[model samples]
Target: MRSNHSCTVSSAPYANITCIIHDDCILPCSFRPTGTVVIHWYKQQIPVHSYYYNKDQFGLQNKHFSGRTCLFNSHIPHGNASLLLRRVKVQDRGRYKCYTSTRKGNQEIFINLEVKALIQSVNMEMTDETVTCSSHNIYPIPQVTWATDPPTAQGALENQTTIKTTDHKGLFTVESTLKILDNLSNHTYFCSFISADKTQVWTASWKNQEDITQEEGHALSISCIAPRGLQNFSLTWTFTSSSEPTVISRYDSRTRHTFNLWEGQAEPNQDLLLLGDGSLLLHKPDSEEHSGTYTCTFSGLQSRHIVQTKVNITVASISVDERSVQRSWWSTAASAAFVLLTVIVALPQCVRQRAVETSTASHRCNGAGQRWTDGLSAV
Candidate 1:
């Protein structure tokens, strides 16, 4: 006799089986049998899988589970009558029963198969300034929940979810967004996607990146690539100092150009805007004032989202290179003077020598006799 079948819980399920959609699910219902016993798995009194006489008895199996159902026959000797269900779907979420007929009597094992939708990959975007998190590629209905290290932030944020069914597969693609009314940092946003069976929560974290260092008077150009694709963004490129942040440039499509420090002066190519890149042609730090922190802030496009990237600018002087540039400039000026002197001093001497050679040739021809001068005098 099977001890597991001693006290049967036929009214409710013995256990709940949770699994993701399109993945394999195991409906566990096992009792140590004597030898070969009859096994029947049912859903709502309908036959899903049946096995008897030491083989899979699928003649009476339901057509809906054809080629998609299997019994763990290798474990038949050990009485592990777990049924493996393949390629789960939303319709597979239901209560099921397992009937095992033995020499002692008939045993009933019940199970609740709960299949949930899943997102294989989640793309999360976080903005710490406003505490907003956004992501797509989710499934079913999604909700956003706020969580902190100490669990202080709860019910303080709001959730916004949107879902659309895919064209060919008909699977749901959910977009979950959250906004924290009170802005703070060092927090994480959780996006919970719930289906009929289970709830999966994904987290979006807020953390700063590494700082940057550069030599003074060298060109600096960095890609201000934001993870979020804001339709229209109000970007502010700022250089931070000990006192306050000075605006290098601020622009948006609507505002055009709010303020640009390098607008009139040539150098650093003012054409390369802050939104594009903060570039200064032949730019150098005047003093320690230029060396501080810098950041590009993007806002307004996303209603509750504020994205910012900080760059700690350490402007170090290139002493050797600076002296070399000075020396190179003076050397170039001296070389230009030497070339001009060579041309000026050598030109008049060559002209005077050519005039003397012509006079000498004329005297030699006059002294050559009347015979030689006859043809020349007539000409």
Candidate 2:
């Protein structure tokens, strides 16, 4: 004999089910020590308006769940009371309960049903040819649909004709291929997912790339290319020093097409330019102040793209005094010439002094010889 208190459901407390329109979802609930018993299904606390027992007998179920609810099996002996809900609806959101009653008593299990309202899939691919959009994740997979703004009715539409879905790790993913129809224009596309209870949408965008380049210590022209047809879009150019790359200069521009650097100029005619290619040009490039990364961003339609490029200014050192080095060289040469002249003047005086000493010694020798001669005669 099995005790009513010990019999319990084995599945987790919440339901982990998702589905799209025209899809089927299974709510699995298993119990212990099961036998043949009368099984019933309910939404919230109310019984289902219609149901089937043992695959043959049918009965009244809830009005909301009519034609959509089914039992996997009613025989509790087999331990299967799983429910299958088909053609789910937004109103299907609520708690569902399954009950099994035997001659002894009744046992129950509960499931929380959630109906997703939006099913969105997003895919992004960057290539030289086009930007492709794809679906990332969808539960209870639905038929994918694609839409775009500035309608693709013109020959400008170049998207791949087919959209495909792939399943990985029990989740469904889809993708759409879109090619660049116009290089000068910006385009946006939407991918949507449809289900009985939920609907989701995602957007992908592309724009023409813009850039600028220039030298230091001069005025530079910076322009950003806006999508060819967009009239209300705004563009701005910002200038910053290289030492603290985040420090903005006063010469930054509020409009994309024109930039004036009267304030951030290190010298006259020196300014920074923002170009359509998202490149920065310094009028007079100063290696000390203009060497670092410059970032450009375009914001519109609740989306933005940020591109950063490094501006390296090669500075040539300018000599302040042109004659200083030449003067030092001439001074060293003059000192060497003075030392040579002193050596030349003292060498002749040293030679003359040696000759005078030799002459005095010779005179002394002659005097000694005469004295000896006189001594001999006296003797």
Candidate 3:
């Protein structure tokens, strides 16, 4: 190895790449090579992969990289020696070296790789009144299970999964869905994912989702949640009945902004407001104003990322009697009762006067009869 005195010292090629753990990642190394040469991929000092004399040499490769590392041989003819790594583990993080050598000289590139875990938000959908929990953009397939506080989630319910490429990078994206046969109304079902070693990665639970119907001039409540590890996201409540949904409230975790009624009526709900699991509480809702197809959208901080759940809030109007509107029931009943009492008191006085008059007439008749009989006897 020799350094040309005339050649100016250049900065070491530095590449910082982020990848989801348990997904495939590529350590980039690009250059225009004319002929076949020796390619060496090393993690720090350990030999990850090596290609020599137009063939792979695994004898010198590290045991950890036995089957996980490969080189794009097709690209090597055009001078690309990027190593394709599969199922990136936590220990794979650190600096890597991609060295290529020809008959006379050698070239090198340095790479800094990072592995991260993304806990996607879980969405529960009710179709024909059946609850289905689903999530997307998950990395390195984790074990998804459905559970409950009481009458725990049985193992009988099966889960469905799918895998796909996430980006230009070799990382993978997974989608999972769980269908619940047991009733979710009375019990709080927990849908979560765990690491290979049984560590709690994320969880979602619901128990208090009672009937949300309300009469006019009453309160209404609805709630939603994301995974446990997720912290930064946007929560928006939109009324979807209109041509274009109108945003009722929006809370952005990145900017810490609370727009609209997020903190309008009741301030205590703010605790549950900014959290991963958000709630909507309309302290006083009018039947005509607040009823419609409502949607809660949870968008990730990244671009073009969102999870949505729909809720049909029914606020029915109640009919009122026109007579009741004129006067209160209690007030009208009191007035009628007072009038009846006065009639009863006046009737007793009239009856007593009539009785006295009849008694006087009877006494006068008896006196007249007695006087007539005495005059006849004297004659």
Query: Number of the top candidate by lDDT?
Result: 3
Predictions in order: lDDT? 0.60, 0.52, 0.65
- Candidate 1 minimal-lDDT segment of 10 residues: 300-309
What is candidate 1's CA lDDT for residue 111?
89
TM-score for each of the candidates: 0.46, 0.34, 0.43
Candidate with the larger lDDT of 1 and 2 = 1
The TM-score that candidate 3 achieves is 0.43
Winner on TM-score between 1 and 2 is 1
Report how far residue 179 has shifted in candidate 2, in Å. 1.7
Error of 2 at 284 (Å): 9.4
lDDT by residue (171-217, candidate 3, tens digit) is 34444544545454455455666644454356555443444566655
| Candidate 3 Cα misplacement greater than 4 A, ranges | 1-124, 133-140, 149-153, 156-173, 194-208, 219-235, 242-246, 252-255, 261-279, 293-379
Q: Tell me the TM-score of model 1.
A: 0.46
Question: For candidate 2, lDDT tens digit of each residue in 222-325?
Answer: 43333333333333344456344342322223443434453444311223233324334445656676665554444444233333344555555435564677
List where candidate 2 sits over 4 angstroms from the true fold: 1-123, 140-155, 161-163, 182-198, 216-379
lDDT for residue 243 in candidate 3, whole number 0-100 = 68
